[model samples]
Target: MSNMIIEQEPDDELYEHYRFEAGKGQSPLRVDKFLMNLVENATRNKIQQAAAAGNIYVNDVPVKSNYKVKANDVVRVLLSHPPFEYLLEPENIPLNVVYEDDQLLVVNKEPGMVVHPGHGNYSGTLVNALAYHFENLPLNSSERPGLVHRIDKDTSGLLVVAKTEQAMAHLTKQFADKTSEREYIALVWGNVQEDEGTVEGHIGRHIKDRMQMAVFPDGSQGKHAVTHYKVLERFGYVTLVSCKLETGRTHQIRVHMKYIGHTLFNDARYGGDAILKGTTFSKYKQFIENCFKILPRQALHAKTLGFEHPVTREFLRFDTDLPEDMQDCIEKWGIYSKSHTIEEE
Candidate 1:
């Protein structure tokens, strides 16, 4: 909440900009971090704002805000022309509060509302809303406050948030230890060959691509992933299943479902039209195929979550009803089921 700025003339800004230098063959650090270290005079929030809005540049190129300094990566930061964006601005977005205590908060995140701010998304996030609600919520990570773990941008459901710093540390530890019970509901194409089973495999980065993840036989350095699931209901060809994570990894449920025979309906990444080719012509199946128009993303939701309260150490649990799009999909499935059965008979 300080307004101190460090501006410099274009020609002479080097070396002493930060208190610490790239020690002996090490790369330079991010401008904001370096500036924070050099002079405790200016607040870090001011420096970060300057860097993000292109007031700071690396090698005269407006580099990514996350760009770490490499050796000779020309560092030029102009704190004088700081963007007037505050570190924490409260937006009056409505939040669905499932449960709230002094220690933590349980929220039902709607589909398409991102959990936190990222590169292209800086506003309208769960954290943004929480910041608005709680005056000064502390976070596990310095950058992200009040977040222990996160659900995907499109996956709607129960999210546990820590309100206090002690709670944040404890809840984060639970997630890391896999003691946090995270349960999800997914509607996948076709009935799984087995009614109950687990997907156990090592997951790692896709060999060919950087943006996506894949299950490799020889698997990379990524940790072991396991998802335990049982059928919740069967709607004609589609099977609704309850999934619990034995091990949490990025896209663990989505990747494992696709690795097995059945993939979630409208999963553009793992489940493409190849599987849909068999299900097309069915009104419900086709609706799911063209689901980009109907639903925000795949038919997946973190429906339930349970964890030991960081402060109380008491077992805490919460659940959320399926979002509107999911309800719509279920209705279409029912309609398709009735007609398809009569035609077969």
Candidate 2:
């Protein structure tokens, strides 16, 4: 939401801002999220509250949080309009529901599943599934509907969805407030020295590569990111660790681990496991011997998520076991990671 806000001080002491309402041929979208798209400077939290407070209108009718909008529905607001393409459409995809109510839907996202439709993808995303399920959430917008937060495409874990404006606002506010908790499990290439530790750095886009991110201090867009981790088990050269995210950003865990000198096994983009093949982890030679032994990508999984229900206001927590491939590697390599090393340059 903070990212959506635009800072405009004053102009001629009486500033003029643009505004518009959804019209026919447009699908229904969340009122708050709608304004987020229409008004480039408005936060989802702000719009959600505004809509809840009856500041938004669909065809001159005041709608509630979950109110479904129709195509070409008039959407009126009190702010200037933006011109960013926000196109999230519904597709028929299967979803594994862990919990659902009138307020939201919590689903177990599988590995390699893209959460949103963008760039190379125009369909086959979790957003499509949500659209299909909710049949056009209160977006009243043209871009991105029924989405509050996101996980990496390759990372598997629980994702919460907002079915209504109130639910979306509460969950998003919780993320901003740092009350909702998200923890992940990773099978790193080497063992950590102590039992537990934390990684902190300012994260932003890599200056050399627009597609990738890098760690920097006092950057223009980079923000502080932190991860708390404790060892779960040890292979001579490898270790299983549990990590909790203090802040969410693109590739935060992978980048932080690589920066700290403990990259995930087989993670080619970072410090890969090639070094451990003939050295330190000699005992795991046979373990890596089998073709299916080592996992393809860096082993990381979203294991736990906890938050207070937006509708019921009751605390809820969920957990998942480690993926099988990671478990196999740990069984063979844990407890013997003597070769794992972090050489700070």
Candidate 3:
């Protein structure tokens, strides 16, 4: 089987740094030695230190460096931090803190804020704000301090940040195991036929366009992703839906909905900005343009997030109201749909 490593370092937590499965007929070997052979630039001393720190796992159980690996044994290296890339400079950007504790905090992120710094976007990110607001927040495997998970830049919602190292590891594991719950409110281009449905496909970078994500139904490429959606409301042309993610991948909902012929409304990257479902009439076109102006970005918002508190182990869930832009757009659509119905009758 192929090893699973998230290379793109997308907008989510990185739990498993490296994973290896020994061959069926492989000879028994020391765990450190086995890893040194497979892991690039890994030394015996480093592996031993990771083992001593309880970061090495064999079949999901912590193992020492000297543990002997047998045939078909699975090995994993989990780290709380990834290789440091940028020197984060604290910026005094204001944050909307919903909840805070000694171990963690939840912030209601606004739209148009990038989660962390990357190429070209080396400043004005959430990480910079976190650095300024909180000193020495624990860094996740992506080297993003305090962030255990992330939503897209234009997708506003709640995100939990770890204040301590213990919280970081604990919360990261919850997300990697797919135990955490996240729900989003989305407006799509077409009227969805089903009230509830599930979309399953492997999501990876587009072959031709590196900036975009594509779905691979054959599982030949990318990581497995699933999105469960429920239709909340349907205008004559567009539909409002709620999507719950089973697996976190970059642009999972946007790509999966597009796969099902219902691209998210106003999602510029996925071609939702165009009037895909509306009429060819100039008035109808102007109405859609007005809605686009009301909601300049994708009509998707991270509405709810649920996870076990890292320190208390109590389940914590946070929900937020839809931003004004989305609400206004939806209301306009409702009015247009009703007026059109009256005219047709």
Best by TM-score: 3
- For model 2, what is the error of residue 73's alpha carbon versus the real structure, in angstroms, after optimal superposition? 44
Candidate 2 lDDT by residue in tens digits, 1-345:
111212111110111123354566668766666667777677877777766765455554555556665666655542334324334556778998888888888888877677765324446878788888785454413235666667766677888888888887788778778898899998776557889999888877555543356788555557778889899877645667888998887778888887787887766566564655335344335545441245666678888888889878999898887777666666655433344333410
TM values, all candidates: 0.70, 0.67, 0.76
Worst 10 residues of 2 by lDDT: 7-16
**Candidate 3 structure quality by residue, lDDT tens digits, 205-230:** 77665457899999998899999999
lDDT-sorted candidate list, best first: 3, 1, 2
Model 1, runs deviating above 4 Å: 1-89, 272-292, 341-345
Q: What residue pairs clash in candidate 1, if any at all?
A: 19-38, 139-145, 139-146
* Best prediction by lDDT: 3
Which candidate, 1 or 2, would have the higher lDDT against the true structure? 1
Give the alpha carbon lDDT tens digit for every residue of 1-345 in model 1: 133222111111111122233445655576667656665577878777766765555654555556687765545554333235535556778999889989888899988897765423567888789888886677554345787777777789988888888888898889879898989999887767688999988876554443346787555555688999998887767788999998777678888888897788777767543445334456544565555456657889998899998877899888778888987877777776667752352
RMSD of each: 11.2, 14.4, 12.3
1 versus 3: better TM-score goes to: 3
For all candidates in order, the CA lDDT equals 0.70, 0.66, 0.85
lDDT comparison, 2 vs 3, better candidate: 3
